[model samples]
Target: MAILRGNPGEIIKIWHGGIAIHGGLIGGFIAGVIVCKVKNLNPFQIGDIVAPSIILAQGIGRWGNFMNHEAHGGPVSRAFLEQLHLPNFIIENMYINGQYYHPTFLYESIWDVAGFIILVNIRKHLKLGETFFLYLTWYSIGRFFIEGLRTDSLMLTSNIRVAQLVSILLILISISLIVYRRIKYNPPLYSKVGALPWPTKKVK
Candidate 1:
């Protein structure tokens, strides 16, 4: 933070505020919802199309946290990492301040990348919003456990991680929405005529 650094002259310091993924997600979600409402579009449908991309982005983004040496987990031993059979580069990075830490960022990145692959392939077989909901469910499930390992996570209390809490809520909400939409609307398939399910259905 610029304020925290006492206004360091370096340009990087001017913008070196700490990471806030949830803030970005919330802001983007709100903005996307507003835009969808204005355009009379179904947000979930749009989300279905974009969900894989979002996860892929998130997967790549965690590497940034790695570069910053933040968002890592508790300390471990080099032998511990060797037991896990991690690559030399990863094993080396885990060593910080004479201690090896869990490569939580790598764990999450791998989870998200895998999710992206699964979601992209499965979208065609899924209902309109299920792709997005599935994305949320998958990501949140991984994030819930991964956040548990993170040492720098935001905390509601000494024992409660903010990301883990949010992840749990997201998983529940996403699954709920998927089940509700499936039963209530019987929505069109993502692989069908179009993502604009309501409009396209009436048009043709």
Candidate 2:
């Protein structure tokens, strides 16, 4: 409705199309909190377990943007894309309307995949509940720059990209929380309790 600059009746149009990942993340967090409360689960532990999987899902989800031909950056040369050494199929899809655009979707997906790898590798070494902060920090770092390259970003102001702004804020907050937790608890990366990736511990 806001993007369309439309009235109340036209607000329904949003149902037909648009969705924002930021909004989804916020909603998911709220839902997670509720579920964690009900289940008597430690939210931080759950967050650590879900961190890598979140990025993995994001990596897979970016393909949807590709299929829809949305979330792409502005025009670029085929030569530029080729120089990046992207796959042949991606090169072909980029060749739309006699021009190639920056494959922002692919860039984000690859970044997410890399983040997943980093998170999984370091997860066991992280303190009791730091993986979630790491996830936020890693994701926001890439998104801050990538959102700048995107032409289709939602705007909070004339010069401000909404996602970029959120990413920046998240990066600061995530890093701050990680520092605070580490100082307070000084936990080792290796966990004696909790399953790999799931954070479930065996009963004594």
Candidate 3:
């Protein structure tokens, strides 16, 4: 928006004015890594342990977004929402600017919950950090599609949505990390990693 308005400088000025979820996640991940280093704990194991909870938190957080009436999709019709079998109050709250909008928050919340269930179910079987990789892959896949429906997405260009771009990158990174871990790291399984002592003395 700043660039479009002939004031690219406003980009930096407006940056501190709002929070982005992707940035928040990256910040949290970095913090987790640093804490793990300081405590001499296994970061990937910790990530695996928290995977389900993280996704569940994301699912719940969308409710807050819903309450704020932000992050909705483009204009939709009352009948369209009705066809989705949404609850009456929810259908009513979607009405904004004299028109109904798609309940994207609801969509993503459902997606996140589904991911949470999957992660929890498979948590015991995955390799250390694979659950976290799966978390990233799953969330990115869902976000890539859901972001298309959002009316307020950050854009890298008029044609490139920032969230979508990040989602793609994360998806690739997750896959690459999984393969690299298996081929190079040959790390312990999620079920076994927790039994290992702290300062396993290796990042793996």
Candidate 4:
């Protein structure tokens, strides 16, 4: 609406808003729920299984931002990123004010990929539903710090950083859910035969 009101200037302002990403997350969650229902799988279990994959995918997707060169730091010389020996394709394409910017996207992508690998490898040791919580908590923790370094960040009415606020909230929610589930279900710390009251134990 603002863009159509003869205000091209407002377009960049609106584009900088985090509404699209926020909505995308909500939509992704809904889709996950639907997929779980269709598969007759436990929602939390499915979430845990998919969490790492989602992060991995996001890592790959971050390259898109790097290509655009829009999500970068305030200012930096090309030599800085070039010293890192980034791909020539990325170096040639990404620029701001005739200088290379901080590779925020690459940083985030590497972070996400590493986090996903760690989570995936350790997932079996985690309690049910706990993996998802940990994924959320860990990812948000990194994001909170990373968002602080970025030149572009969405803001609330009070000019508070929206991504930072959301990251904190997610971290809190993840911790709360993990604690709540531990208290409520009291599942076994380790898997044992017939540990759960379900299928009968087989006779030797």
Q: Could you say which candidate leads in lDDT?
A: 3
Query: What 10-residue stretch in candidate 3 is worst by lDDT?
Result: 8-17
Question: Local distance difference test, per candidate?
Answer: 0.82, 0.82, 0.90, 0.72
Considering lDDT, which of the candidate structures 3 and 4 is the better prediction for this target? 3
Per-residue accuracy of model 1 over 1-204 as CA lDDT, tens digit each: 335357556424425665466666777889998987777777777788789999999999999877877789998888988998888988898788888899999999999999999998889999887898888889989999988887877777778887888888888898898888778878878888373334522210
User: Candidate 3 clashing pairs?
Assistant: none
Residue lDDT tens for model 4, 63-123:
8787677777656677876898988876766676677667778788889999899998888
CA lDDT, candidate 2, residue 117: 95
TM-score for candidate 2, residues paired by index: 0.86
Write down the lDDT that model 1 would get.
0.82
> What TM-score goes with each of the models?
0.85, 0.86, 0.91, 0.76
Error of 4 at 72 (Å): 2.2
Q: Which pairs in model 4 have colliding backbones?
A: none
| Better-scoring candidate (TM-score), 1 or 4 | 1
CA-RMSD of model 3: 2.6
